[model samples]
Target: MLYHTSPNYLSSQITDNDQLLFQKKKTNDLKEKKDAAKQKLAKVTFACREEMLKLREQKAQVQLEKLTKRKDKIERLIKLEHEIRELNAKTFMRIKPMHNPTTTTLYQNIVNIFYYMMVAIVILGFTYGMTKIAISTFDSLQNNQLTIIAAETNLFKLKEGVSDIFETKKVTTSYSFES
Candidate 1:
């Protein structure tokens, strides 16, 4: 349908429409600026978060390295402590000399005495064994000499018996018969 309208009304409506378009353009521009601000804020927040994560990772790595070093030191300390304990538990004769003169003298004397006692015991045992061997040898020699004497006496007696038997046979025999 077509309707007749006044020029004043048309002109007023067109001006109003132009004002509305300007307002819309201004609002769109404001919205674009806000969007850009939001995007910038998000980027900044992401960057900050990434930096924090990196810092945290670095801190963790440093902490781990520190703990590892501490653990290594503790292990070395434990080994050294064990070695010290071992050294402390060892006898003086097994290692370096004692520091104190009196103690060193005492240790020396004790060691010397023990050594001499062991040597004396060994020598005495060896001498006793040798003496026992000599005595046994002499006893064996005496026994052999007695056995030889006994054997010689038995041989002489056997000869005498044989001679007596021959003499008896000779006396008992008569003259032989001629054939």
Candidate 2:
């Protein structure tokens, strides 16, 4: 199995082997460059997509805040409108104030009548109190007059008795017992 080849055959075999190795090395280098380009493009695409998503999220947040404020404002306006309607309904519910003729005159007449009635009652009460006081004063004066007349009659009787005793020649006798 140790058969020797000729020199020509050996040189041809070496040249063919070197050509194949060179071709293989070229293909490997091309494949490595293509892989590097693909990796770089993938990284760039990923970064772009991430930035787009972040911007979209920020825009959505701003829109949500605007929507929330708008909703609150609408609710507040509706509440104010409801309160205004209730106030108007409550204040204007009465029909008499809206259709009465000379309402001012009627109101004033009523107030005046009440005022006069109260005045008359107060005057009557004062007159009654004054009449009671006058009657009591007259009774006290009559009682004083009667007392004065009785005292005068008593004094006259005492004077008469003294005159009678004087006319009878009354003498005073005195006796003393000494111990």
* Cα-based lDDT for every prediction: 0.86, 0.80
Kindly report which residue stretches of model 1 are placed more than 4 angstroms away from their true locations once superposed. Answer: 1-4, 92-179
Off by over 4 Å in 2: 1-9, 94-179
Against the true structure, what is each candidate's TM-score? Answer: 0.47, 0.45
Per-residue lDDT tens digits for candidate 2, residues 79-131, read 99999988855644421332344334545555656777898999999999999
lDDT over C-alpha atoms for residue 62 of model 2: 97
- Please tell me which predicted candidate would have the highest TM-score against the true structure: 1
Would you list the clashing residue pairs of candidate 2?
none
Q: Quick one: how many clashes does candidate 2 have?
A: 0
Score residue 7 of candidate 1 by CA lDDT: 80
